[model samples]
Target: ETLMEWQEQRQKPHVAIFPGFGSGHHIPLLQLAKQLTVYHGFSVIFFTAKWMGASPHQTPPSSSGGMIRFIELPDVQIEGDHAGMSFLVRIPLLLEKANILVEDALTSFP
Candidate 1:
């Protein structure tokens, strides 16, 4: 491939997606990301918080057609008793910390 082709690939619009905290949030967003990369010729970065555990239906990066990238942010532990907490109540706390990590990751992304 020529340098121009490589440069053009790099120039594809980059999309960053944060699907909050679970499968309900992640599944639809993953579909959107796949469509954006496959049909729209854009590159997508899908971010997940590590504390949420494995996604219910995520493909490994190697099989993503080189268009979608998955970033699993370092987990941030929320203090106090989370055993009784509802997911909705805990999301805000997780996101508050995840946002900073996201920012850092984006800054270093190509």
Candidate 2:
């Protein structure tokens, strides 16, 4: 390819986005991801839960010409008494369990 194209590709800033559990959380972040790639010329890595809890909007739009990528963190199992707990109270535990996978994904990201 051309030098300009190579330089532009190399210069694009990379952004890693991990939205919260439900659709309410995912939609806004997904919008931001789209804007970053489409308008700001950024490369984005969007992370989502493999098994979305109660959100109907599971499938987000596809990547923007390879500038944005979607990666699913493997299903996180919530054990113990969390079933009776509210979302706010249980989210920390959920995220803690998912942290390792997130780190791995970021480390191996190209």
Q: Which structure among the candidates has the greatest lDDT?
A: 1
- Candidate 1 root-mean-square deviation in Å: 3.2
Give the Cα lDDT of each candidate. Answer: 0.79, 0.76
TM-score winner: 1
lDDT, candidate 1, 1-110, per-residue tens: 57986688789988898886557778788888878887788888888765766562356445346777788888788899999999889889888888888999999986
The C-alpha local distance difference test score for the whole of candidate 1 amounts to 0.79
Error of 1 at 82 (Å): 5.7
What are the per-residue Cα lDDT tens digits for candidate 2 across 8-89? 7768998988887777878888888888888888988888775554332365556566676778788788888776899787
**Model 1: per-residue Cα lDDT at residue 90:** 88
Superposition-based RMSD of candidate 2 using all C-alpha atoms, in angstroms: 3.9
Off by over 4 Å in 2: 1-10, 54-63, 78-88
